[model samples]
Target: MTVVVNHHGVSAADVLTVARESATVSLSVDAIAAMTKSRSIVDSIERDGRPVYGISTGFGALANTFISPERRAELQHALIRSHAAGIGAPMPREVVRAMILLRIRSLALAHSGVRHIIVQALVDLLNHDITPWVPEHGSLGASGDLAPLAHCALVLMGEGWVLGKDGHRINGGDALMAAGLTPIELSSKEGLALINGTDGMLGMLILANDDLAHLCTMADVTAALSIEAMLGTDRPFHPSIHAIRPHPGQGLSAANIFRLLQNSAIMDSHRDDFEHAVQDAYSMRCAPQVAGAARDTLDFARGVAARELVSVADNPVVLPDGRVESTGNFHGAPLGFAADFLAIAACEIGSISERRVDRLLDVTRSRSLPPFLTPDAGVNSGLMIAQYTAAGIVAENRRLASPASVDTIPTSGMQEDHVSMGWAAAVKLRRVLDNLTSLLAVELLAAVRGLQLRAPLQPSPAGRIATEFVSLFAGRPGPDVFLAPILEHARATISGRDLRQALEAEVGPLA
Candidate 1:
C-alpha cells in the first residue's frame, strides 16, 4: 500500500513501513498545488529586490551578503556544496530513505518555497530506490539537520554519491541518469529550504519509537517467563494488590501476568503451597510499572513525531498571505528531548532485566534451580559470563542514556550558537534499543534453562509458549554449546515478534 504525504502528517506506522519495509510513497495533489503557489511568492520576492534571508541574500554567517538575480541560482548551488560537509561512515540505508521521505513531506507543506519539480525529484529518488549516502554524523538538528540534509541536496544537484538498488555505490550523477532522473538547478531559497529542518533526527526518533514499543511488551512477556521458571508466585500481580497504587501500567502488567499463567501446572503447583516466598522481587513484581513508564514515554514521543510530521519546520517559511519570512521553527529540541527520554527508558528497562538475569544465575537467589542454570555447575560455567555480557551491555546503555541535548557548541560565527544535538540523541537511542534487545535475550536464555530444570513441574501455558519459542534455539539445556548462536537466535526471536506471538496466540494479546 502507498503511504501518502498529505502535507498534513504521516503516521509512525507509515514511517516504519517506508523506512524499513520498502513501502511505496506519494505526494498529495493539494501539496503539489501548495508548492507551486509558494514558488510564485519566492519568484515575486526576487523581482521586488528585497534581500530575503535565503533568496536574494546569503546564508548563516554570510546572511548579510546580497546576490544579483543572475547569481542567485549559483548562490543556492554553492550553499549546498559548502554545507554538504558531513564526515563519517554512511548512515544506514533505511535512515537515508527516511531522511529523503521526510524532507519531501516537509517540502510538501509549501512553506519552504521549493518548486514542485524538486519535490517530485525527491519522490522519484525514493520510488526508484536511489538512496543518498548521507553520513552518520553532522547534524546539529537546529537550523534544521543542515549538514546531512545538504548531503542529500547535493545528490539532487547530481554532485554526490548514491547507493543504487543493487547495493553498489555509484556517482550520484550516474545513478540519477541510470534511473532516468535529471539533476536540479536550485532557484532562490531552494538550497536553504532543502537543508533547513529536523527531518533526520525526527526520522530516527520515529523508528526508535517503533522498536521500543514492541520491546516493552516483550519485556513483560520475558519477565513472566522468568517468574514461573524460578517457581515464583503471580499473586503479587493481583488486581486487588495493584489497585491501591493504580498506575495504569502496574495494573495492566499485573493483569498480563495473571492471564499469562493460564492452565499452568507450575503456578498451580505453588497455588496451594504456603512455602513459596511471600512476594517476588521488584523486577518481577514491578515489571509493568517500569515497562509501563516506557510505554507512557513512547506515547509522548509518538505524539511529538505526529506533530513534526505535519508542521512546517522550515527556515524562511512561506505564508498563504503572500509573505515569506525567516523563522525558528526548525529547532529540534522537542525531538531531542523525546529521543533522550526514550533512551533513558530503554536503559532502565534493560537494567532491571539484567538484574533478573543475575538473579536466575545465582544459586542462592535462584532457589531450587541449579547454579547458573547449568546441569553440572562445576563442570560448566554455563550462562555465568552471559550475565556479564548482559551487565556490560546494560552499562553501555547507561552511558548512551546521557542526554545529548544538554551540550552544544556554536557554529556559523555564533549565528547558530545554541544548537540542539538531537542527531546525537537519536543515534544513541538506536544503540540503546539494540542493547536492550540483547539484554532481554540473555535473560530469556537463562530463564528458559531454569524452566527446563523445573521439569516434571510445568510452567504456565503462557510460559510454555515462551520456552517453546526459545527451544528453537535453546533445546534441553545441558552444558553450554556455542553460546553466541543461541543468543543471536534468541535476540532475533524476540525482536522479530516470534516469541511474543507464540505466547499471545494462547493467552491472547498482551498490553
Candidate 2:
C-alpha cells in the first residue's frame, strides 16, 4: 500500500502500514503547495534579518546568540552533530522506520518551514530501505526526541550510518549514493525541522496500541478457556449482570466471554450438578472486570495517539497567516502519560492471567483434574514450572509498570527542564507488552492442557478450535518432556495474530 502524506488527515493505521509493512509513501500535491507557501514565508523572514529561534539564531540555550548568513549553514550542521550525542545500542529497524515515517508526516504539514525536497529525501530513504541507525538512548522525550532524531537527520546529510535491506550496517553517504539519491545540505531552520517532533515516542505508542488491542481480545479467549477447564460457570458473564456496570469495555469483554462459552458442553455438564460451587473464583468469574479495565485504558491511549497523528510538534511553527511563532507542541507529556498508562493496564491483564494459570496448576484447586494437569501427579512435574514462569513474568511486568512520565531531569543548562521521559516510557511499555505475551502464552498452555485433561467432557466450540490449533505447536499433553520448545512455540502463536485470527474465523469477531 502507498500512503499519501498531506498537511492533515493521516491516521494511526496509515503510520502502521508504512512503518511495519514497508509501505512506500509520497507527498500529496497539496502538501507540496503548502510547503512552498511556508518556505516562502521563512525566506521573507530571513530577508528581514530579524533573529528567529532556529533560522538566524542558535538553538536551545544558545537561542539568544545570532549568526552571520555565511555561517548559518554551518550552524545547522553543528546542531545535528552536537545533538546526535545519543549513547546506547541502535534502536530496532521497525522503530527507526516508524520514526522516519512520522517525521515525514510532521514535516509534510508545512508548519516547520522546510523545503519539500527535504521531506522527499526522507521519503526516498524509506522507499529505498535505508534505515537510519538511531540509538536506544539520548532522547529526553522533551523538545521532540532530539538526540535520536539527530541521528536520523545526520543520515539525510549523508554523515551517519544506515542499515541495508539485508540488515547489514552501511555508511550513510555510501547507502544514499548506491540508491541514486543525493545528500541534502541543511539550510536555515531545515535541520531543526528535521529533528524537533514527538515521532519517536509516538511511533512506539501507535505500534503498542495495535498490539495491545489484539492481546485484549486474546485475553478474553484464554480466560474463557480457563473457566471451562476449571468447571466454572459462565453465568457471571450474563448480559444482565454487566448491564448494570455499563462500562463499555466491561460489557465488551463480558460479551466476548459469553459468546465464546456458547454451547459449551463442559459448562453444561455441571450446570445442574449439586456439587458444583455456587460461584467461581474472581480470576475466572471476574475476568471481564479486570480485562475490561485494560480495554478501557487502551481506548484512552488510542485517543491520545489519534490526536497526535495530526498534531504539529515543532518549536517554531509557521502559520498560514504569514506569522512565525514558538510553541510547546514538541513536549512529550501526552505521549509519556499514555505509554505509562498502557503499561499499567498491561500489567493488570498479565496479573489476572497469571492467577488463572496458578488455578489450573493447583491440584487442590483444579477441581479434581490431576495435579498440574498431569495423570501421574507424583511421577511427572507436569505444568508445575510453567506457572512459575508466568509468575516471574508477571512480577517483571509489575516492575516495568513504573511510570516513566513522573520522573524528570533538567537539561541544556537548565533551559530545558521537566522533560517528559516519554521515550523511556515507550521502551518499557514495549517490554511490558512482550512480557504480557509470554505470560498469556503460559496461561493458554495451561488452559489447553487442563481442557484436555477434562477428557470426554468437551470444551465450547471456540475452545475446541483453539485447542486443536494450539495442539499443532504444543504437541499432545503428556509427561514433562522437553518443555522449552513447546512453551516457546506457544508464545509465538499467542504473540502473533494467527491464534486470534483463527479463532475469529469460527467464533465471529471479538471486541
Candidate 3:
C-alpha cells in the first residue's frame, strides 16, 4: 500500500513504517497543486525584479551579496556541491529513509517553493529503494542540517553516491540511469529548499522518542516482576498510598504495578509474614517515583517533537503573495532540547534497573535467595559477573546522559553563531537506548533466578507470562553451565517485544 503525505498531519507510526519498514511513499494531489501554485508566485516575484534572500542574492554570512541572472543556475548547483561536506561513518539505512520521507512531507506543505518534479524525484527514489549515502556527523542542526541534507540534495542532482539494492556504492547518476530515472536540474531556491529543514534531526528524535516511551512502560512492568521475584512488599504500590501525593505519573505507575501483580498467590501468602516487614528498600518502594518521572519527561518530549513535525522549519519561506522572507525557522534548538530530555529519561531507566540488580546480588537484601542465585555458589560464580556488567553500563549511561543541548559551538565564521548540536543529541539517544536495553536484560535474568527459589507460590498473572517467556530459553539455570545464551534470551525478551500488547492480552487496557 502507498503511504500518503498529507503535509498538515503525519503520525509517529507512519514515520516508523517508512523509515524502518521501507513503506512506499507518495504526495497528495492537492499538495502537489499547492506546491505548483507557490512556485508560480516565486517566479512572478523574481520576474518583477524584487530582491529576495537566497533567490536574487547570496546566503548566510554572504546574504548581502547579489547574484547576476546569468549565474543563477550555477549558484544553485554550487550551493549543493560545496555544502555536501558531511564527514564520519555512514548513517544507518533506516535513518536515511526517514530523512527522505520527512523532507518530502515538508516540501508537500508548499511553502518551501520547490518544484513538483524535485519532490517527485524524491518519491521515485523512495519507491525504487535508491537511498543516498548520508554521513552521521557534521550537522550542528542550526542554519538547518546543512551538511548532511546537502548530501541528500546531491543525490537529487545525481552528483553524490548511493547504495543499490545489491548493497554496493555506485555513482548516483549511474544508479538513476540504470533504473530509467533522469537526474533533476534544481531550479531557483530548490537547492536551499531541499536542504534547509529539520527533517534529519526530527526523524531521529521522533523514532527514538517513541521507543523511549515504550521503554518507560516496559520498565514499570519489568520492575513489578522483579519486585515479586525478590519477595518485596506490594504496599508501596497501593492506590491509597499513591492517591495522597498524586503526581499523574506516580499514580499511573502505582496502578500499573498493582495490576501487574493482581492475581499473585505468593504475594497474598506473604502479607502476614512479619519477617518481611511492611516496607521494602527504596529501589523497590520508589520504583513509581523514579520511573514515573521518566514517563512524564517522555510525554513532554513527545509533544515538542510532534509540534516540530508539522512546522515549516525551513529558511527563506516562500509566501503566497510573490515574496521571499528569510527566517530563523531552520534552527534546531527545540528538537535538541527535546532529544536531550529523552536521553536523560532513558538513562534513568538504566539507573533504577542497576539498583535492582545490585539488590538481587546482595544476599542480605535478596530475602531468602541463594548468593548470586546459584545452586553451587562457590564453584560457579553464576551472575556475580552480571552485576559488574550492569554497573559498567550504568556508568556509561551516566556519561551519555549529559545534556547535549547545554553545549553549543559557532560555525560559518560566527555568522551561524549559535548551533543546537542536535546531531550529538540524536546520536546520544541511540547510546542511551543501548545502555537501557542491556541494563533491563540483566534485571530480567536476575529476577527470573530469584523467582525460581519461590516456586509452588506462583507469581501474578502478568508476572506468570513474563516468567514463562524467559523460561523458554532458560529453565532454572544450574551451576557449571554457559550463562551467555540465557543472557541473550533475556535481551530478546525486552528489546522490541510489544510489552503493552502482551499486557493487554492478559489483563485489560491499563487504567
Off by over 4 Å in 1: 164-168, 275-277
**lDDT minimum window of 10 residues, candidate 3:** 495-504
lDDT of each: 0.86, 0.90, 0.82
TM-score of each: 0.97, 0.98, 0.95
Output the number of the TM-score-best candidate: 2
Better of 1 and 3 by TM-score: 1
Cα lDDT tens digits for candidate 3, 300-354: 8788888877888887998777667878998888888888888887888789888
Where does candidate 3 stray beyond 4 Å? 7-9, 164-168, 498-500
Per-residue alpha-carbon lDDT of candidate 1 for residues 281-398, written as tens digits (9 for 90 to 100): 8877778788878888888898999888888899889898988888888988999999999999999999999988898988888877888889888988899999989999999999
Q: After superposition, how far is residue 507 of candidate 3 from its true place, in Å?
A: 2.2
> For residues 368-421, could you state the per-residue lDDT of candidate 2 as single tens digits?
888888887788989888888888898899999999999999988888987999
10 residues in a row with least lDDT, candidate 1:
271-280
